[model samples]
Target: MSKSEEASQRPDTPHYENATGGWGSLKGVSRILADQKPTFGAFRTLMRQNKPGGHMCTSCAWTKPAQPHLFEFCENGAKATIWDLTRERCTPDFFAEHSLTELRGLSDHELEKTGRLTHPMRYDATSDRYVETTWEEAFEGIGAKLKELDPGATVFYMSGKASLETAYLYALFARLYGHNNLPDSSNMCHETTSVGLKRVIGVSVGTCVLSDFDHCDLILFFGQNTGTNSPRFLHTLKAAKERGCKIVTFNPIRERGLVEFADPQNPAQMTVRPATRISDIYLQVRPGGDIAVLAGLCKRVLELDAERGSTILDRAFIAEHTTGLDELEARLREVSWEEIERESGLRRDELNEVAGIYATSKNVIGIYGMGLTQHVRGWLNLAMLVNLLLLRGNIGREGAGISPVRGHSNVQGQRTVGITEKPENVPNDKLRELFGFEPPQEEGRSTVDLVEGLLDGSVRGLVSMGGNLARAIPDRARAEGAWRGLELNVQIATKLNRSHLLPGRATWLLPCLVRAEEDMQATGPQAVTMEDSLSMIHGSLGRRQPASPHLRSEVAIVAGIAKATLPPNPRVKWDEWTGDYGLIRDLIEATYPDKFKDFNGRLFTPGGFHRGNAAREREWKTESGRAQFTAPEALTALGAPPEGQEITLITLRSNDQFNTTIYSFSDRLRGLSGPRDILLINPEEMERRGLSEGQVVTLECAVDDGAERVVRGLRVVPYDLPDACVAAYYPEANPLIPVSYRDELSKTPAYKGVPVRIRTDEAGA
Candidate 1:
């Protein structure tokens, strides 16, 4: 059977009559009953579709190909795969039937109903429809419009899925055109972690590679759900557990995946029942209370060391490579136990137990995700993680370091290949040396700044490498409105998403090749590089046929735009860089020798290569040549919850969802299905407010700013969450987050920690 025919025949197919079925339907029923379900193993196999070679899901960068024939897939990964392999298609005729205005009125689900775009398209104002356009015309039109705008007014945004080669060329094109306004999905997620790490350590990437997980004696995971977010890491966790590693979890909500994960690799476990125990000590922390918890742990560790009268920390490593120790120690000493317990929602005894685990384990791994970075004090939280690692001299050692799990396949690689609004010291100097042109020294706009600029008409053009910017930004209404004002909006993507609907006066959607599809050049098939969450750089060669014959590689598309926009000033040859992605890798190597030594040569190897992180071996790279300590002051209580607010809402990702991409409406692991309109609340909190399961509640942001944003009539499902805290799906709840509510230094949106009020309307009173 053909791909489409086969997809329709699948048992897990979405039934339009039902509107919601498969795993999503199962989740909805589970939520109603307030119970967890064991659909992960089945969901894993269903997502992969029994494809030959048995590949791992590529939803997040963290997924690694499992051994021989293991069926391993996370809930979100399943959704991503299902979405990609859906039996949906949006042809030119479909566009002809609906005008942009008509499509705008359609729900997000209805718009996505048209299926995926199969060809390049352009918007025609006269017909009020999008018509299929040739690759040359699309490229030429984008180049012309971009040429008209001053480079300063143009912004280049990238998503996490973009390969390293494409990212490198995207950055080169912007630089060649004299603009540094390159914002990406990273800005929306892990920018705070990057900013904090760069200041504390010399590098902005994670210190540990995946191999480090195998050697860890103790794993401290904060604000991350491995089963749903990074299922591939479960194997490592399972291995570590079998070897007696203590895994401690700190998250507000009790994630099913983190609690118990089933391994599809073992036949006995699969045929009968095979599940791995994930967390030994699951600490239920209040939202934005991570800093306090970490500080308390560090303080207890210090106290323990003092009593033992022996060096618990790697003193030699700290003295040689870090600075600011005295200040960090003083801050930790000043924080009282009373304040720590109250703020972190953990008692002194609990802190001591956690510290005791760390004290006994010679090898520890600290893994963090958006939970630690999506708060008002996200940067401080990252700094605190670094401080905790430094306290025990975790860096530059076997099985010990800081690991920031990145969201996209090549998000970190993009940064390595020069995708940054602000140029780093090494990349800047190298760009100057390689291109023989003085790179811009001035800073450029971040994601938040880009939105603000677009709203005010300062940003005239937007070039998205990949991503649905309109749906991804904080305030949906404001962000979409800003895009409407743009003179030109160009989207280079493999699929059609909501961002494509937010047309500029002149808009172009250029079709590009996906990482899973082939990219043929004059030389041969080209390979693209991606950096994993562990800072390991590797190459991916797509074997499947191109989704469309007309589709071009991102590198070629970028080069075409550059050739059309820029005057013939060849500091670095543009035409010569199109076909072979290896040429781009060579440029990256020339620009960043320390990270990409013999980039092309090493990439050809089977397992690829690791970007050297000396700090992983106890070599600190901070000012003063010694590990510096950053003592966090006691968190001053934010005056009691807003007077009359029933519950505080915290935004989170459903198991079947990712960043802003909704693979399906169901959250099987959470027992939620059918729709994402439900809010997960603690049962006690709901009863205290005189609310019951399935009750509709209106969530309002109690912001100091005058902006009004509300999500109404959301169903409430009681779950195992802290009493004062309630959890709702993100992007849908993004409106509740105020633009001003961001981390002080990193400027990350405090999506994980927002103060809001819930109210129920009386029916037929």
Candidate 2:
């Protein structure tokens, strides 16, 4: 039989569907509850998610509305909760049943399915197993290792799931330990957004709030899939659509959430009517083509202004609130329509049509995610989007601005509370006054920098708040190997993950409380705070009991580490802060009084308080004192691939996954089931290459690092994507992305775009 014919018999061929978030979404939630069979009341716990004074969903950073619905959680949120509240425990006996070598062979999903960690454990090198240890012993050993090494040589990593209080304590603890080597998940996902927006608008975050969508006339999406990444955002898009907002999306694949959505909240929409159409216009731009598309939009807008008596351009806003218009205009004028169309995989008229839509609309909101940020020119990609918005003064106005959707529930919050590698970003003077210590001024290593340090023996220790760092990062061949050779590795987490298997010499696994579970401290049941995507700070209080008796709160864990590593400071009372989380809020208020005045009292209020973004009020915190328009020198930063490896790969998240956590082996939105090791390519591309469905192929990266960087046994499945653009799940595809290949400014690994060649894995077949 022919390869195509033989492959056609496979059951998991790629399928496209238009509907998302109706019955399918509800079914997804039900499946997780049925499969995991939570020991705790899943529905009861879910009812409290994202509600006032209830624990925030540990899934995504999408903000909660002023008045939330009866149920304020999504399908993925349910999975995260159920996963955390699982009945199965990874106790010492469970460890005794599985050795380190045996555990290392399991996939990330399988490792997590083993269940929530129930006790503190240390690597017993003699038995090759993680034997249970007392918390005092674990902390003492970790502290001793830190005392033996230079503080600068140890890196502290924070995951996006950390609470504001936990992040604050972690940051302070690292500072007290005499180094600023702190890196978080943002360094890998949205660092470009932070770096680019700060340079252009003086703020490192997005300008739009959730309510802004209610007033926006036009909403443009670039490289973000809301259905899987942040399902709550679909309601925002649906609301905007119902109000006659023109939604335009530019993505390589037509995402179901962006095209149509069936709201589970609305009974009529769920049971009576068809799915609501979300996007008015859809542009399937080629991978790494966002820059060219953005430049083309600007070029067309300029043309419309010239043709229509300069009415299309917001000249007044540009004259008063921005600089470098002349440079931007000249650069746009120089860009040829042919080049724009060729690079963007779009025609001149399509670009003109979108530009016309923008011109007609009074207020526009530009929304994007990692697609625009994970590139070699990731910073440039965001800068171009900022320039596009600046043309018509979309920023600093109601219902109009740039919204960069963040992944982690507290990723932005972590950065807000000083979990950054850059020391200058922190209020050093306030820290000195509050903690009575001279904070480190030297810049610390970012995630990318830390990985390089691991290889060079510069960084010997890693203290993570929570995350599967080994799998999340790119260039795993070097990173995972270097991880095993570390002198000390400490992971404070709730569940077992792949990162735990790559053991250091003295690895310690510290069990901590999750968000859905109550944290009973010395004072009473403690509540933690989180800052959502809109910069709103709200409280998260858990109602369920702790998953394990041995588990401690993240705040207590950080405080314990601090007390053990540093000498007692009379000014910094670690024990007192751990007892009462309110004291930590008071300290945070004292440190950043302008942002968090009356932090304790205000947190009790419904929907929390806005942290106040300067850019939203026409206040630029940049060097120029105004929003700046930067003209990109090229259409895109992506160069030609090597002769054999022609396609560019963009890593993505499945519907069943959040970050590195996989709940199942299915993605219903894309008709993928039972496997993640499948590549989605365009039918035309597949035919041209003489490839077939279910054909095993190996994707090899185009980098000369003296190591063979490839992901083997990825079956080919035809998908709806632009030519030369293919899609694969993240972390699996992370191996093909070179560590050195990243945005120069942010150092974020190019997870969105990687040049690679495909080879038939004959041996695997």
Candidate 3:
């Protein structure tokens, strides 16, 4: 049998019965440490993560506490840190041994396991392998190629893996190159939050501070699996629960993180295995049902406000700080109970019960993740969520607001420092005045737009800072083919990924320093800043020695490219900024004086400085100068699927993975191990469809596009999920997601709620 077929036939292991983050978590960490043995200062590096005078964890964007615990890192964070600090090296000989064809056949986990990249390498077509080349040769060759094409023809993509200094330089470099085509990881994830919130609240970020969790009376979580994505957040939830704060969660899968948590930092809890109960209420919301559930809650809250003599609604606050209440109320009233029940998979009374909890609570905070944003109407979903929160005056309150937990530690920071497709999002006048360049006024291509341009032969090159674009993007089969025809493809990365294999005519793999490794520039060792999910900026100082002498910092890499590509601008000192990151911070402060004042001074101020939020301060930047309540045009978050026996497919991450990087083949939290190409379905649904356990299946996208988008050799596993709703690992299932299928306003691909038909694979038979 073929290797792919053999992988599809791997049997499901017994589910883990322990609570999230107990002995099981410690075991997971130990296992990773054992695999990547003799890590470079592993103990010292982990001790400093999320702590004062230390670098931030490269995992989730969770903020550190004022007084962090002895070990603030989580299981996955440890994996990420150790994964970077591994002794294994992918030297020139390693690449020469493995051909591109051989690398392409490996799984995501296997590809990343190859170890850290040691030197700059260029794709040698003659040998069909990557051969070592000096940094100067790679940079000069790429610079020459970029000079040949129009600035708009080449796309500059950034990932969340880099520091804020790198992101700032990347944005500046893109604009200096005469285009604003700065698409980052945000384009695929929380672009919906930024676009949606700005339209109503006048700000593109969350309004809550980390301290707000302490004072909140209630916290509502939607479509976020905090355990796997942001395990450190479990500490915040546990603390809130102990302080008499109620927690309610809505997700299709019963993620162990929200249900209960045993803090790894707490010796008593870890030893006893008596996990602290987390969610006061757990609602199994069906995929793409968040908007319907939110609409139902809004309607019920308004009704209760009337019945209770207007006491439930903050009438005075509404009159003073908001607009469009009457229209929102009318729209909410139009939504029928039957439609809400059918779409949300919940009864009216259940929604009313939750709404009642909201009405009684003086201060409530709503937290969400990609689940709310990776939908067709993702931007609208955020608007509707804001409407529900605004009814009780949650916008500018101390302990009541909206928090969109971002996946990458610095993804939010990248957008904040000016990586965006929309030209207007950045300060054009300030940039033109400071950098002496005419910033492009026309909107640039987003991730989705970039893919379309590639397919149409409009985009000729891709300069990605640090993301696996080939696998992270939708319709991988179609996009990867177009990538090969490009004139240039440059990837500045610390390790090899699937994207490096999709080599263009001029492909160069430039190695950079990881966050855990010291980045010594021309001046001396430097520190980089990272902004967390709550808008707090923390300084990251690497303690370990450099992995290789040839490695360059991301800031230096960007500066090298910029200096080589653009004509020498006297005002911009790329060489000096690359030598000292603090200088870059000074310039960033100069650009956004109000938001980043004293950037260097506040780099290590205990818990880091909070970048002030205008909406949180009640200073709305909207056209009306006040918060606006919006209602969805439709009750459903996603439109109806084409006629067939199709099920809603929600793409998710495994406990062993962080973003697109798969650390191991095991997902301990879900009781699954081995291969990620497994489809999770409810037992009753499996029985109803005459599907058996361990059955290999093929999923085809239910789209009208002539091209067939399908993934084969997926093992079926019965899971505890809502009927007609199945789940699959992201990027693996990403091929089934259409590039054109995205949010209208934000342009985020609908990774969640994808409609697909599953049939038994002929290979398994």
Cα lDDT, all candidates:
0.72, 0.87, 0.87
- Candidate 3, residues 1-765, lDDT tens digits: the string is 421122211233235667899888999998889988846588899999989889789988988887988888999899999988888888999988999998989877777778889999999988889999998888899999999989989999999878889998998988888788888889999999989899999999899999898889999999899999999899888989998998888888778888789887788987865788888777788888888899999999999989989999999889999999999888878889998998888778778888989989999999999889989988878988899899999989889999999998899999988888888888888888888888888889898898888788899989999978889998888888899889999999887899999899999999999898888888898999989999998998997887889999899889998888989989999999988899999988988898899999988888889989999998889989989988678876775743568888999898988889988888888888988889999888998889999999999888768978888999898887888888899879998999988887888999988889987758434
Instruction: State in Å the error of residue 617, model 2.
Output: 0.6
Model 1 stretches with alpha carbons more than 4 Å out? 1-57, 63-82, 85-87, 107-110, 617-619, 636-647, 761-765
CA-RMSD of model 2:
3.6
CA displacement after TM-score superposition, residue 252 of candidate 2 (Å): 0.6
- lDDT score for residue 438 of model 3: 88
Which stretches of model 3 miss by more than 4 angstroms? Answer: 1-14, 38-40, 761-765
lDDT of 2 by residue, 1-765 (tens): 421122211233455454789889988988877877797575788988898888789999999887888889887888899888888778899999999899989988888988889999999988999999999998899989989989999999999999989999899988889889999999999999889899999999999987899899999899999988899888888888888998888888777788789889899988779888888778888888888999999988888899999998899999999998899988888889899998889888888888898989999999999988888898888989999899999999999999999999999999998999899899999998877899998899899989889878888999988999989988876788888778999999988998898889999999999998889989999999999989999898888878788999999999888888898889989899999999999989998898999999988567778999999999999999999999988787464433564788889888889899988888888877888999989888898988998899888887666877888898888887788878899878888888889986899888878888888757435
Look at candidate 3 and tell me the lDDT of residue 216.
Answer: 97
Tens-place lDDT per residue, model 1, 38-136, is: 223324434332132333345787735323234444445555554543445677788889888888786565665455567789988888888988877
Each prediction's TM-score versus the true structure: 0.89, 0.97, 0.97
How many pairs in model 2 have backbone atoms within 3 A of each other, for residues 3 or more apart or on separate chains, i.e. clashes? 1
Q: Superposing every Cα of model 1 onto the true structure, what RMSD results?
A: 7.5
The CA lDDT at 364 in model 2 is: 95
**C-alpha positional error of residue 3 in candidate 3 after TM-score superposition, expressed in Å:** 42
Model 2: runs farther than 4 Å from truth? 1-13, 639-644, 761-765
